[model samples]
Target: MSDKDVAEDRAANADMRSAFDTSAAGPRPPSEITGHYSSDNPDMVQFVDADGNRLETTEANAPYAQIVEDMTSQDAREIYRDLVLVRRIDAEGHALQRQGELGLWPSLLGQEAAQVGAGRALKPQDYAFPGYREHGVAWCKGVPPENLLGMYRGVNHGGWNSNENNFHLYTIVIGNQMLHATGYAMGVQTDGDVATGDPERDTAVMAFTGDGGTAQGDYNEALVFASVAAAPVVFFVQNNQWAISEPNEKQFTIPPYQRSRGFGIPGVLVDGNDPLATYAVSVAALDRARSGQGPTLIEAYTYRMGAHTTSDDPTKYRSDAEVEIWREKDPIKRMRGFMEERGHAEPDFFDEIDAEADEIAARIRHACQTMPDPPQEAMFDHIYAEPHPVTERERAEFVEYQESFVQEGAH
Candidate 1:
């Protein structure tokens, strides 16, 4: 054959081999593929609609449905309480910021269900690493509400002791908590605190972050470490649509949950607004971790109904229609509907909750106004576990400097 004829033959052979390659063969049977790409897939798992309607699903939605069905009457009530109380506190914090009582405040208005459900599912021994906005989780973990506010108010570096609350300080740098949480889980393993079939002694770590956090190097590294070490941790990503005006689509072509597959970990996507769904998935993941299973990634499909923080004005980049779409799926409202349907609570119960909410709002206002500013010396006191001569000398110098500046109207 001529040189050109030989090259053509080789190319033809390569094409033939590619067409009949059997290396990709599996046990699964092949079916006629029907391809359609539309956003209107009804098979998506949703236990509760935006209108507070209960939904049904088949085996396809079984995993998500499990989360929904796990919601009990008491769970519904408690979740509602958490949502209301946290929002009241959030509003007060925002007002305080406006009034110059606080340096900043990150509202948890739209994320109550995600925080409450996941927080409530944790065992007392399970440690939690939170991002800055997790006031709701802090509350559920029994950290005083003031403790969270104090940090934002610039009165303290971090208000509560992590050891006392089993809640770590709110990590401001995105995705840093993932490494910390993984390390803690590794410690749990080193101590052999994992369940050897003993439920009570088993422990896990839950780490929180946002959709934007998923793009960070630390976040990906944490997942790699957790998977390789089989660390008992759950990476809870609350994909509330917007990470400071950037939508989820801008960050990912596929959902965040799919990212877990690359790390050899199971990934789950739940309707984050559904308290029951959030609770169910979180509890199960924790249980699995306790049982020596590796880390799981949960992408809570929710929306950020409020600004990223008090400093952000989301209206500059997002539309009112977008916000309204999420408002319809409000987690608290869905739980209320479930509670009323089951007769777990009555209208009077809701009234009582409202009254309590008002009382909480009032208390927060009082606390914000009355919480004394920390003395300058207090900053030096907590810098180290033990005294340092250099710090002491600096503190004395600071005090002397202040005294020297005293107003001089002849005393």
Candidate 2:
């Protein structure tokens, strides 16, 4: 096309975008800015309450409760074990970064239940696309915790084979993974993987993002495409009260789950700190997709108990009072309390879990400290199918520069 033609097309796009602009509305005031954490939304699903009682399910949540009831005590115990270990992994990740063992770490300190519940719900054939803070999901999918350190430690892209576990490499760009998941789900649909009436053959995809991610165009576009194509996927949004430092008010007026309905799909809100609730809801959503019901949006109503990353300071935006309130609702603590009240575990079992967590944490620390660095040239290996002159030149220059440092030290 001629330059004039390209210029005209660009102008046309600019005009179309300008028509939908809403910048004149201005931002909401601080007082009017509300968070998902403040109110108790009665419609939210819960199989266990914050105070450790077996919660009475509401009409909206009764179906999920039935699913939870079908779960054996062993199942609950397994979830509890995951909740504890996941928390330990998160703590270790943070400590590793602080001790300069890793380059950076994104702590999933408060969302263990949200991740483990959804991660445990996946079938072997199902695929998962995760945002950066999905360490718990990685654990549930059988990814070694040390594998995750490679990424944060600046040693490699990702540590494990995604295909081995049906978990994709963590997407650092916000909301981009949703599109990847949607496209994969569409492929599954085209390949006759959904609604196949064979549990083993039927497949679903899961896309995970935080509440702030819902505001991205890629996220909305992925939902639109998935809904229209009847793609078998589930969008799991962990609403951890803040998007980095910005609160929910900066992202959207309604919760993400409620917004899913506008895209012609079902949505559900669950007590993200409640493992049984999250697991039941995720099972239902995955089932719906495998049965050709299209995508489901689940907003795991939870909190960010730590800084967004090791680089952030939560004190700049959120208050201690707020963090303390959510700390009381910690997934591991709540699950332990509920299990104790229900007599699902003995004191010895708790002791064993604590011991196990410590052992696992020790192994993770050792792995992070001793991981071998990738060869210097390894960075440029996958940039193109064949080597380019520019890449080869850079590689030579890097090697000479490193050797010069060694020679100077020898002198």
Candidate 3:
């Protein structure tokens, strides 16, 4: 209990702190390089490698390969078109945000194939519960690209009715859509719309979430419900390797897809950057769901090539070398390479696609500029399905306040 005893105790604590310091531990190996369990696992389904070469369909991919084999040259070209067009739309959105046209924008720059492939795999009867960055999926659901800009442009909360388009409004809360999708799938099963043996009559649901969302309590809870109910839903995790600034390694030790099996649902991992692989895997998963085989989890291994959102700065956390590595494995470029190699696409086809993308970008830019701003009173709209006195009162006050501004000759 003296100064000498205190000095010894302080010295011991300093040693313990130094032992736990990660900075003093020196640089740990990159997760992409050291922690890639997929590369070593032969069961991982991968149809194409980084350089765009087609790999043989192995046992790992056998279940999903049939759909890809049935795909025609025209189908391949169409996939490529969708991929390029979506990238253009995403790029344009990012530009709009930079130009101060939008409050914020989430770029799906590198994950286009993951969205497009899964989106194209759905039937008209199926429903999708999407996370906010699902612009590519929205494109496939027949939602106009401009519809997505409404929330960002401060026009509306969501621009479309989910029931009308079979795509739910984007859920900003991470992992919340997983629950919505599960509940919707349970409803579909209760309605007897599943396993009808008639493709047109059967229905399935897709729940889209990012790697980060997988860590949320809602995601796990949804999995429990879906497993017990045998719900016709697919939990699609786009493991873009980062949940904003937190890397996948920081989120969990096990791969996201692998975690699905613990919930009694089958899990499949695929190359998210490969459109063919993603499409094939999604088709198999969707088919299983429609057949009442219960839910499946698919983790699309991709990289977020841009900042998580306009408000983010990726350069602060990640190295440029890492980004450059992913750039070589660009999904759109890989698909284009595969198409050209198989003689399914020509130089002219790519040139035409470029022209189309350019036109689409121009249209989006014009539409964003022309979008009408919602009146301040409209902020209270859609807060409740039915009229509420509080919201009505707020709207009235907001309108009166605006009138007072005009009366005072305020700009």
What do the candidate models score in CA lDDT, each in turn? 0.79, 0.87, 0.88
Q: State every prediction's TM-score relative to the real structure.
A: 0.86, 0.88, 0.91
Clashing pairs in 3: none
lDDT of 2 at 71: 88
| TM-score (C-alpha) between model 1 and the true structure | 0.86
What's the residue-level lDDT of 103 in candidate 1? 85
Better of 1 and 2 by TM-score: 2
lDDT of 1: 0.79
How does model 3 fare in lDDT?
0.88
Across residues 57-152, which tens digit of lDDT does each residue of candidate 1 receive? 655357656656656677778888888888788888888888888888888888888888899989999999999988888989999887777788
**Higher TM-score: candidate 2 or 3?**
3
Candidates, ranked, TM-score: 3, 2, 1
Clashes of each: 0, 0, 0
lDDT of each residue in 77-136, candidate 2, tens digit only: 999999999999999999999999988899999899999999999999999999999998
lDDT-better candidate, 2 vs 3: 3
